[model samples]
Target: MNALFLTFLFPLIGFLLLSFSRGRLGENLSALIGVGSVGLSAATSAWIIYQFNVAPPEAGVFTQQLWVWMSVEGFAPSFTLHLDGLSLTMLGVVTGVGFLIHLFASWYMRGEEGYSRFFAYTNLFIFSMLLLVLGDNLLLLYFGWEGVGLCSYLLIGFYYSNPNNGNAALKAFIVTRVGDVFMAFGLFILYMQLGTLNIQELLTLAPQKFAAGDPWLTLATLALLGGAVGKSAQLPLQTWLADAMAGPTPVSALIHAATMVTAGVYLIARTNGLFLLTPDVLELVGIVGGVTLVLAGFAALVQTDIKRILAYSTMSQIGYMFLALGVGAWEAAIFHLMTHAFFKALLFLASGAVINACHHEQNIFKMGGLWKKLPLAYASFIVGGAALAALPLITAGFYSKDEILWEAFASGNSELLYAGLAGAFLTSIYTFRLIFIAFHGEQKTEAHGGHGVAYWLPLSTLIVLSTFVGALISPPLAGVLPQSVGHAGGEAQHSLEIASGAIAIAGILLAAMLFLGKRRLVTAIAASAPGRFLGAWWYAAWGFDWLYALLFVKPYLLICRLLGRDPLDHAIGLIPATVRSSHEAMTSTETGYLRWYAASLALGAVVVLGIIVLA
Candidate 1:
């Protein structure tokens, strides 16, 4: 447990040393510190996990109580780290994938201007995510939650000289804050109703204290879902992530692959008991996941920027996780979460290599046939794309994603299953659309070739993970989780698995037909007005952002402008001047003269008597 605690400390220390040194440490040293700390943390996590597997905690859980955080009357909450299969699973993703990203970043960010500052933020993000997953109580989790939000804003706007980057950072911060508000309210409601913030306590107490369909419990669950929606980039709150690509590519990988976006899934999965009580809220989770996956999948299809394409893909894939959670496929959701991290990180890092090789060109339309120039990256991207499309059971994504589809179908919700299938199709189409357009076309630009081991190593590891990690880890993960969570087998019929695979193949062929050799139908479709409109709608994320702008952003901006001479200022102006004049008049009455005193007394007496007589 102490070693588990040290996992967070290493990154925290790394961030502090690098940040406070103020560039005196130089680029190479800063890079070493950042990557080294995360690597060490990963090592420490492995050791802790090894120990846990050996001894096993009582009831398969371990809690490290560092201090008594707060107490009032009979209420108390402590600074604690709760480790179980759930937290350990998340810890593994955060530390393991995070370390790989850091390594990839050490190369990707090599000599960037804000090199030290970049690593500082990266280390801090790891520490924050660790706290977020490792916390034992809601307050501690919120602390880490807000920490990651702040760190994300900093990292996203790392190139702050550009106003667009700054605006993007602010957009992410403000949009996520909307969900955080709901989460805060949810916490308050839960506390008021249940009188506890400790997660295990709440999990134990909620069902015992409240019956199924309790309104207060439902509201609390819904509120928490709002937070998940914002963080996970589920519907309505997903607009920020596409813009978040303004940061360094490694930051994009970190956020989309391992950290902030996955927080919502972890949150929902952690409090499975609470949600199980509210069937309606569970259904809402599936609805949000299903709708978001479809919309984001559409958005990914039309995106030109490589990172933004991956961004929308990240959103859609998270939707699958949400769908799994909704259907009580907890193990499936977590499995997808892990596999998605491996493949998505691989895609992002490989995309970084492509972008670098092409002199920072991010538009997939501009990149062509790097199959020879940067064969490693090209092959890695294919693997990532294959995994993303869940190219039949060979890739990690097939095993995980098909499980979600099966779970959705097994739940007997035709709508969810159909939506999941649609999302799968869209996912495959866009994933290979980018692949075929970028990898199979005539060389549009000459690419500067050759990357160091620093670049190739991470991609190779992730390529392997994306190809096979799901099958390797899914069964072990199932054993790790509670039995009631639902497994990949049993009622998750084989027929549905075949159907999901066929749909994935159909999408790949569709992408190849439209984008690869002869793009005849795609060209004809692009020429039509209806096709143009649909493309625009998909590009705009189905106008959800527009609706939000009209509903929230425009009114907010208008209010800010109106506040230049705020109504409060006018009312305040009236009060202060009137007070000053009345004070001056009163000062005149305070003169040390018998006549003035007598006059004041007489006036006061006259006014008092007049009022008394009227009464």
Candidate 2:
């Protein structure tokens, strides 16, 4: 079998075996299978990358046609895998980061009731995401898309006994379903016009088939953007993520960091040609991304729940990716995607340790002076937080995020550039606020558990990668993408870099004063009326949930009640009662009495004679 096929199979086999294990598998065996499968896939991806570099093929594309999936008149979708530079980049992250998370989940969930089940779901997610990145056609992509959604629903509500977890899973599924509708329509339009679901064919023909400002192409791109926005949790579709903290921590690391959230970015980058044809839609993508980053940052600032803080941070960072894509910086977006995967996963795994350490207490105010108790976790958070804040010159986030700001400036989009810079400052403040408050205060809560090889090992590995991996991989990534990716011009780029770094530094200093300083500015702000109002607003995620409730939820419930107890049901019910009443009235005539019987006989005879005569 081809290496591409093998990469997906390893995870598939692992998921099947563990899912059907029925509690027969030991913890060690389960961990070995789950971790080993993804590890091998990562190894395969590395080998593929090496081979591609040593002997590059035409257009740097590799196609493996396995079989026919479906066929119609002049149209067929195949079970094919397409490996190119872009996919290769995603493959490394998905498999590499995914393996570490699976390893962590094994130890983290040990002695739990559904240990095998958790690993099963994790492996399934890895398989689904691999298919998503490697699919050769839109049909396969959509299959993988919905597959991951199903797995996320299962895994997010992994603690199914809790009603809140179930609600969160349902909310995530229903919200993203709205966007899937638009994406399905988009596929229809593209297939109707182009008569092909093959991705390479679509890319090759889109330019020759449509003009720069064509409405049809714009409509299609906008529809696809709908799916991207919902999947990436941009703007209106974002409320579900904060609630998703109800799941296990490893699930959070898997979905938010390396796999599902990045699908939207990959979709946009993969279909860059179609987006390029519709410049109007391209600009809109940037606007949505820019607005989301700032909005999420405000929400993150006041968030006290540690997991929810990371949830909002995920939204904010994804906004950066979208902003990069909007400014025609596809390479920069991918770079940020890779680096964000490593650091964000590290932060989540480290936070998991902290949560477990405090006996599962998630409130940051309740946790303090953990630097000594959990030294590994402390070190991991410091590195991860620095990367998250885009700390100057030394961290991975600075390189990738600053590259985006430079492109935005070079594109003459000062508005976008400033929006990005504002996001940078907020990122710094919220990230360090968590660090200082959680690590610098008196020990207010008793702590236990969360010290083991599985937890700390993943944390340490991610820390190493987040620190230096960005610089090492840039040359390979640049080689993978087309030549035009990083060619934005001039001295202004350098100025923006320095300015972004300075902004990050200033925000960090401000955080030191607000959360860790003597005046207790965060508390003071919480005390005031305006600050209280804004805190409520931001805590409610600017009340997006309430708005949707009024707009969609209430109306939906009303309609359901109307259908359930409609007047038509009463009308239909009345018919049976009417028949019973008529029957009773007719039965009264049959009451036993001699005179009545004689009269009835005489009347019956007369009526029969009259009927005979008429006939």
How does each model score on TM-score? Answer: 0.91, 0.95
For candidate 2, the lDDT comes to 0.87
| Candidate 2 accuracy as TM-score | 0.95
Candidate 1, residues 256-313, lDDT tens digits: the string is 6667799999999888888989999999999999999988898898889999999999
lDDT of each: 0.88, 0.87
Please report, as a residue range, the 10-residue window in candidate 2 with the lowest summed lDDT: 475-484
List the candidate 2 regions with Cα displacement exceeding 4 Å: 475-490, 517-519, 573-615
Candidate 1 segments whose C-alpha is farther than 4 A from its true place = 72-74, 475-492, 565-568, 571-615
Find the number of clashing residue pairs for candidate 1: 0
Among the numbered candidates, top TM-score falls to 2
